[model samples]
Target: MTRRITVAGVSKFFYLYENHSNKLKSTLTNLARLRMRKRRKFWALQDLDFTVDQGEVLGIVGRNGSGKSTLLKILSRITVPSKGRIEMFGRVNTLLEVGTGFHPELTGRENVFLNGSILGMSRSEIKSKFDEIVTFAEVEAFLDTPIKHFSSGMFVRLAFSVAAHLEPDILIVDEVLAVGDQQFQMKCLQKMEEAMSQGRTVLFVSHDMRAIRRLCKRVLFLDQGRIVHDGPQEEVIAMYLQSFEDLAHIPFPDSESRQGSGALRFENLALIGSDGVPRDEVAAGSDTILRMRYRCLSHLQNVIFSLTISSLTGQILFRCISTVELDSPFSVSKDGVVDCRFPRLNLNVGGYLVEIEASANGVLADRVREAMRLQVVKGAYYEGALPNRQSQVLVDYSWQINPDGA
Candidate 1:
């Protein structure tokens, strides 16, 4: 099959701030007397190579300022590449930024045709699909209202509706989906899936890993304007999420005096592997250790402390409290620090937060909301029947396929 979109060694450079002129004071000083500002080059894209077959949905995942938007802009022809080559075989419709091609002065109804024409759609073609676009966006009430009066949400809704329904062979989407509500985002996802099933090509850039994993068979991981990984969805997303987790940890302050609830305060929380040295990063499916130190005020009895391990979504994966076992209740004296250690962490490849909570006599007590977040980075995983807390839960069981089919 011939490739529908081919990007070979694509490189895009941009000036940090182009076309600088002192307007108010300089206009009277004479046009020729104005000082020309020197321009500095910034490379938004570098030697990027990828080919999309006739019917492929490619997902791009990266953090903010990763140049994902710049790549999409280059593909949409809104910006030209500084040094690279690209070939497109069919009509391309892009939903790049918020209200990229919409005319604020024109009514929503009028802008649809204007955008369609800009995408090379015929007037009759747009006319036949006009109502459908308005209905899909659910902006019929504001169709006659000028786009300048519409809210940001309304503008993006109408813009996406126009771009998606134009029937372009290749569709490019950036983070613009974030403008819609959850239900609308799902609707757009379904539409993209339908388009993919019909053999249309799509290039999606989003920070949402779940959407990327669900829609695309392959993904590209971008870092600082360069492609670091391009492969299966699982692998690429894993790499990107790992990189994110590594960077999530902010350096602890040097001051030993940390503020917290006066009743109880946590002094330090650190990640220590089997080696006992402090570590900021840990591999997934490994024996890791979490150590926390805290000071208690006023001697308390029947004190139960709980540790919660959670993902970025606030889903609790592992929980351990002193009350799980009735054998005894943990107690701490007044004005002294205590330590708690959790060994053998079994988490998949992702970032997790360790939160500590303490209560007395079954009453509400103090807790650290997001005390520390850890990144579980690795490829290997243990799969078995376990409580489906999150996507991957390990029961730590081993099975073998015997000839008797056990």
Candidate 2:
């Protein structure tokens, strides 16, 4: 396979200032002051080495400060790395945050031409795909209007259409796709899949596990600006999520990591299986129970408890709220345990995170992220094998042909 992207010992660092004045001071400071400024510098990315083969869809995942964006910026040539080097084989286009490449003052149509020109496409080449871009965006009616007037959804649609249709050999997509509606997002995904099919290399970064799992078979998990895991998508995702497994069991509510009011606190979190035992492992089609223990120092009214199940990539799969599910809030002055049951936890085989949050009278009382790690092993979620890699949710159904004797 051909190497489309090569990142060799690439690292980036930015100076952190207390305020705007401090930043300006550091910039104009003499070498002596610059030495002191070095102490306040922040390393956004560390030595990163990786290569992307032609036509490979690479997924990058990490927490907000894990340097995903910085890496992409370096790859797209938007910024220079502090050290190391990178080589790419083709033109790079980016769908970064909303309002990245296009000028807000320019009309949608004008921005389309400007972006095409910036991508090194001739005027005729851009015009050839102009109608296609506008139609795909579904903003033909407002093509002449300044994009500043476009809603976020419209902007994303237009941006994705342009980036995907511009015929760039490489596309670097950020999490901006979340700004679009579901249908548009799916359309963009299909367009990207098509691009990859024809040998375009894509570097995708998203917190949405479903999208990453769908587009990229290989993934790179970053932590603290370093490559922590680089391998097949599923395996890397599982390892990334389980990185918190060791800390999930840490004593909760009392742990300094959690954030919430001091009114009510989560004491312990337990997952009970069908066989009347506690287990971290659950089958895909098996019944599961989440039991949360909490305590309060004084009388609490309208105490709302919530349990959330999310994928390794932070996509919220299910949420069970007390007031919404039970139709009434619990008035608790003493410690107790709350239970939420899932008759058939229809999740695909993978590692998941269980979270807990509680509020009293609209005030956030306690919140814990990744309170525990739950592993969903393979099970009979349906009569046959699982539907596909993208089918995270399993359902029981039957397919019949000629049932009506047509």
Q: Which ten contiguous residues of candidate 2 have the minimum total lDDT? A: 378-387
Candidate 1 similarity to native, TM-score:
0.59
Report how far off residue 405 is in candidate 2 (Å).
59
lDDT of 1 by residue, 24-53 (tens): 665555546775445798887899999998
Cα lDDT tens digits, model 2, 177-199, are 54455467678778878888988
Candidate 1 residues lying further than 4 Å off, grouped into runs, are 16-40, 101-105, 145-156, 255-406
Q: Give all candidates' CA lDDT scores.
A: 0.71, 0.78
Alpha-carbon runs more than 4 Å astray in model 2: 17-38, 98-101, 148-152, 253-321, 328-406
What shift in Å separates residue 230 of candidate 2 from its native position after superposition? 0.9
Which candidate number would show the highest TM-score if scored against the true structure? 2
RMSD of each: 15.6, 13.3
The true-versus-predicted C-alpha distance at residue 164 of model 2, in Å, is 1.9
Q: How many steric overlaps are in each model, in order?
A: 0, 0
